[model samples]
Target chain A: MNTEKILLDHGSGGKISHALFADLILPLFDNPELSCQDDGAILDFEPGRLAFSTDSYVVDPIFFPGGNIGDLAVNGTINDIAMCGAVPKVISAGLILEEGFLLKDLKIILESMASGAKKAGVKIVTGDTKVVPKGKADKIFINTSGIGILPSGIHVSGNNAKPGDQIILSGTLADHGIAVLTAREGLSFESDIQTDSAALNTMTRQIIESGCDVHVFRDPTRGGLGTTLNEIAVQSKVGIKIYEPSLPIKGSVQGVCELLGFDPLYIANEGKLICFTSKQDAQKTLEIIQKNEFGKDAAIIGEVTHTDPGVVLLQTAIGGVRLVDMLTGEQLPRIC
Target chain B: MSLKYVEEFRDGALAKQIIKKILAVSKKPLRLMEVCGTHTTSIFRHGIRSVLPKNITLLSGPGCPVCVTAQKDIDTFIHLCKQDDVIITTFGDLIRVPGSGSTLGKEKAEGADVRVVYSVFDAVHIARENKDKQVIFCAVGFETTTPTIAAGILTAAAEHIRNFCIHPANKLTPPALAALMETDGIHIDGFILPGHVSVITGTHAYKDTFEKYQIPSVIAGFEPVDILNAILMLIEQNEHNTPGLQNAYPRAVSDLGNIKAQKITSQVFEPCDAVWRGIGSIPSSGMALKKEFHPFNATKKFNIQAIDTPEPAGCACGKILMGLKNPTQCALYKKKCTPMTPVGPCMVSSEGACAAFYRYN
Candidate 1:
């Protein structure tokens, strides 16, 4: 605990590594299976199907407004499993640290992961840590893998979106991407925006427990809502028509996007999910989602159309229609 | 946060009214070339082509700095990256532009220290931080970007930042317009001038081109309403046979433009004969650092050599930029080329015509 910085010996599996595991990580993620010092967790559960999802967080800066890479990594996989209509149970954290990383900063990150697990009622059952030379990698990178138990007879997928189905967004879009963007060192812009990185398992559980014949659940993470909708359209072999005015966006994020010439439609999001449901159940599903704390800004942004299979269209707020194509290449900030 | 003027210019009713006006005034088939990459994107993003009358066609021009950057310049960047103790910093737009053997992106993946910077100041800061390494900025842009880069060089010189240098491939808008007008089989009725570049160069920059070509032209903003209104003006001018210049984007652009910025740009750099990707060499079109600031020129400082090379075979980016052919007409488009594996700069740059077509189509 008195170490000023992380050393190569900390990942060497010697006495130093053991002390790091025992003194730092183990107590924060203290659980029966993890404390046993086994290679992996041995779990016992009732007869059911389980969903397993893994994601890596290599976001630049690592720390941004509202959250750091720690919670973002945990919440990312948790949301991934939640999108599969399952209750996330446990997660494993993998940290790859640069040699000169500060132990104090690592503790802050670990504390964030522990609190994130506590909030979601999940346990960090197993983990690994590694250290590389100073120039081998960025300051820190985290990888999280999680397991979830699916409810009986739950069938939700990107392919399930049918014609006439309503598309519901869980909340406002593009917070996580904008937050990281504004927090970047060189390209920093002043904005009161923060990452909307949160556990979506509880909110997703509410919808599945409601049992209203939900067709699809997806987290629009890297490609934003526009690309995600295009994906659903292609997967379901249907066309989607989204209304621009109904979409929710914070004015500050929108302003930043405007200045940078970025379309919020293509920016990344972390704490939101899109649901496609039948017309009759759409109202009920939307209301149930709206009741959740994370789903406060939820709205039906679009609908699946019978025509133009595999295409996504946006009806502009100003009364024009434009095709929302799949985002191509890295969306760089524009000079014009 | 809700931008008032932004929302006003995007007014649906105003766009509809302007479209109606364009429809009523149009008499003959017209090909209007929007000379800015940003305008091309805005036009396609709003389905402007779909709304316009069948007779009127909007063409993407050679305005994208990335798309127009010569292959030799790109090769020079990759070559510099291969040298030891050198770091190449560039705008995101030029990172993907293909050279003869590789791109800056490919070199970076192969262990080169290639960095993507948003502005010239970022590269200067990188040089200041890494005193042991030489930082070469890939300076490629139009008037909107040149002044900023010039300012960065001035700051670096004042601070005596010896490690900081730039490989400037900067271009001028008016010269490129004239080059296009002189090309054979290039018949554009009117020009939709660049809004941002015009903000720096002003409406007066196009006066020479207008006098020579006598083509109806309007400097238009990137909003749907502004574009529609400009289209109506161009339609009226074409119908009346009054081929002249007008500034439709008066709010941001003026008669003289940003004089201080222009002055600084002139102080730091001078016009030199520059080769464009598909457009060949245009006299005094490219900007190079002045002889007094040779120390700030990366090519001179590092003794790097330019590799003269031709465009990729079957890539119709030049013709496409000239407005002689649409994106689909390119032999390699969506066949041997795509955004993922771009065969030309037009497909690589976000502001490129092929990229705009591929995205919105």
Candidate 2:
């Protein structure tokens, strides 16, 4: 507690390591399973299918407008499991810190992660920490792995999309990507853009419990909606047609994209999900999503098609149709 | 947080009305070429081609600075990066553009000091931070970008930043349009001129080409409504047999253009003969740093002469740029040539005709 910066001894698994965990980590992520101090946490679940997911957080700056890397890491794994129509139960955190990384920053990140788990009604059961030399790593990196239980007769996957299924986006696009890019070291732009990083497991639970016929649930993260939709089209052997006018994007985010010559469709999102539901239940499903705190801007953006299988088409605002191809390489800014 | 102009330009009802007007006016089997790469991208991005009449063909032209960058210039950029105590800073697209032997991205992976900077001023900042290293910015853009690069040079010169320099591969748009008109087998009825470049060059810049060739030309913005409005103007001109240069993007572009930016560009650089990637060299189409700014010229500072190299075999990027061929006409397209493994710069740059066609089509 007296240390101003983390050192190699803090991760040695000796006296210093235990003191660091008991004083700093344990107080924030307090729980019965984590307090036992065993090799791993033990848990029991009711009769159901198990959904396990893991993700690593290596975002630059490690902090942004709405959220930092800590909550992002926690919510990312929780959303992954939730996308499979499961209720996320417990998560494990793995931290990699630089020797000279500030202890204060670590405390803030840990506190956010703890709160993120509490809001999602999940437990931080077990965790591990390691420290490398000062120059060996960028400030800090986190890996979170979580498990969830799926209820009976719940089925959702990328390949489950069928003809006539309406596509519902949870919210606006490119908030997280633009927020992080603008906050980077040299590229400075004045805007109030914040990362839409939040736990979506609660929203997913409502949709699953409602018993509306659902086909697919995917969080458009790294590749955004464009790449994720292409993946679904290929996986389902169906075509998709999204209306340009129906896409919910913030005006400021669109402005940034125009200035940098980036397509919002290909930008990343952290707290959004794309759900595919039958036409009969699409309206009810949309209403359910709109009621959630993170789904105020949820909209039915597109629909699955029978023609042009394996291709995703966008019905442009100007009444023309074009292919929304999968992202080729990193979406680099145009020269002119 | 909302942009007023962007929304007004992208209004769905306004775009639909323009499309309807274009449909009614476009009667001839005309082939219109959008000279700017940004126009080509906007046309595809808004699915403008799908709404136009079947008789009208929108051809992509040699406006993309990165796609039209010569192999020799790309080689020079990679060569500069390989030098010790040197850092090659460039726009994002140029990193993946393949040269004769290797690309800047590949070279960077092999331990070369290469960085993708958002602006030329950022490269100047890099030079300031790394005092021992030489920062060479790979400058490839048209009139819309050249003024900014020139401004960066002025900043570096004023601050006495000795290690900062630029590889001036900048090009002028008006000359390229003239060259396209003279090319054999080229058949273009009208032109959807680049909005950004025209903003700097002004509506008067295309006067020579418009008068000499008697072709219909209209400056356009990148939004759907702006492009559709420009297309309608071009169709009306062609139908009435009145070939003239018009400016549809009057909000951003004017007859005189940005006079201050033009002055700054002339202060730092002069017109020079530059080679195009697929097409051969055109006279006075490229820009070179002025003699007074010789110390800020990367080509002279490094004493490196990049010999012109042959383009990749069986690539039809040149023909495509000239509006003589489409991407599918190329034997390598969608087969050996793709966005992931591009054989030509056209496939790598986001504003490239091939990349736009591949993505939207």
Candidate 3:
């Protein structure tokens, strides 16, 4: 129990493996299905339509300010399924550890995953672990697969967007990308920013249950809001226009982006979501989202237009219009 | 936390007021060129072109250091990566720039020890940490970045970091402007000088060029209102037939500039004739390490000979940099060249006019 670090033997399926599951993993994610310690967990469910998703996390510097790769993996997969208008039920995790990774850090990560699953009202039913030699991988990586049940008479898709649909962003942008970049060694900066990684299933589920004409529910992750909106606009064959003044951005995030000469719209956001709905329900949905803990800064930022199909335009604060194109490649810090 | 400077300049009302004044004073068609990559990016990001009067045409100039980097210098960096126990360090902007046959990025992917660093000091640190390997920093930039590199070399010398060296491809702004004016068939009515460079060399740096060329020039900050205000100043100067060097960004720049930093740059480097990518050679426009500090010169230490590398055929980057042609006028823009398979440095560098045009237009 006092082992300071993981070794190759941790994945040998011997006493070390069992202790890793018992002393660290089991105490945090205490559940009967995981307690069985079998190859798979037996599940019972009623016959209904189901949704499934799987994703892997190999984030550098596995630990960040607000959260780490563990909870990010869980919340990412859960939100993926929830954005489909389904209630995420069960999840599985797979861990790949480097030989020299600290077991104490592993415990912290597992506890984070547990808390995230607990808040989302889901269970981590089963998982597998494997350890690689030093230099074979980064410190740690996680993969999560999730399943959710779709309720009757509920459907949401990117293609469901229509002209006159309003776009509602969940909250402030660019916190997670800036946090991760600044935390990296040799790039440290004095700032109070932190990663915004969290589960968005609760609010998304409420919106679906509110009987609103919700067209699309998307979490803008890697490419941020600009690329996400472009995807929806293309899929729906409609034009989109965003008001630059209405974008919910924290002053600190804006300052960092400006200093780095980066566009806040193209930066990543871990916890923010973009909801596309009819104009009539945009205010109601915005008010509903503001009620959730993660959606306090939500606002209706843009709307779908009929002209210039598949193009996203931005109306600048000074009354100029330009195309908000999809992000072509990775955004990097400028030398200036 | 207040970001007072950013908020004040980004004011929508102030931006509108500047545009209104510009619209009122602008009578004749004017050809204005923004002479900084950061300005190019800011203009596009703010949608400045969309709101400008049709009579005023904004053209991107040779302000991007990456775009102006000599083709031969890039090829030399790629060749140095092939040397034994040599690790090439560079800024992110120079990584993907294509030379004659390869880039540092391709060399790294092929197992060369090429590392990206935010500053020259990081390369010095890497050399200090790894005594067995020689760390060569690719020093590519304009006046705004030269002083810091010079300071890093001084730090390396004081600490006796013998394993660190620099491949200097540094350029000057005023000489390039003078070169552009001397070029035949290049017509630029006014120039929006670079703000960051002006902050270092000060407003007096452009006095000689301004007096000789009699060109209307304004050094403005990199904000929406700042740029619009500069445009209005240029229009008024042109309308009244009065040409002068005006510092629209007076908050940071002064007549003398930061004297201590200027002295630091002079102590480590000397002016040399440097070759620009499409513009050929501009005399006394580039900086090289002083003879006393020749040990810090990667080219001298590695015994690498400078070989001229030819630019891509039919590439209009040269004409674009001089504002003689637009990026759309290029035969290969968006056809054979793009941000993804870029054949020219203009297409690759983030602040390149071709890139801004492709992304914004």
- Which sections of candidate 3 miss by over 4 Å? A1-3
Worst lDDT window (10 residues) for model 3 chain A? A327-336
Ranking by DockQ: 2, 3, 1
Evaluate model 1: give its lDDT. 0.90
Error of 2 at B18 (Å): 2.1
For model 2, what is the alpha-carbon lDDT of residue A302? Answer: 99
User: Which segments of candidate 1 are over 4 A away from where they belong?
Assistant: A1-3, A36-39, B1-4
Q: What TM-score goes with each of the models?
A: 0.96, 0.98, 0.98
Kindly list the per-residue Cα lDDT of model 1 for residues A1-336, writing each as its tens digit.
456999999989999999999999999999998999988899988988999999999998888999999999889999999999899999999999999898998999999999999999999999999999998989899999999999999999999999999999989989999999989888857667989999999988988888798999999999899899989999999999998778999888878887777889999999999999999999999999899989989999999999999999887744667889888776887655
Clashing pairs in 1: none
What is the DockQ for all candidates, taken in turn? 0.53, 0.83, 0.63
Query: Highest DockQ: which candidate?
Result: 2
Per-residue lDDT of model 2, residues A4-48, tens digit only: 999999889999899999999999999999999999998978876
Please tell me how candidate 3 rates in CAPRI terms.
medium
How big is the positional error of residue B76 in model 3, measured in Å on the Cα after superposition? 1.3
User: Where is the poorest 10-residue window by lDDT in model 2 chain A?
Assistant: A1-10
Which candidate, 2 or 3, has the higher lDDT? 2
Per-residue lDDT over B54-85 for candidate 1, one digit per residue giving the tens place of the 0 to 100 score: 99999999988889988888888888899899
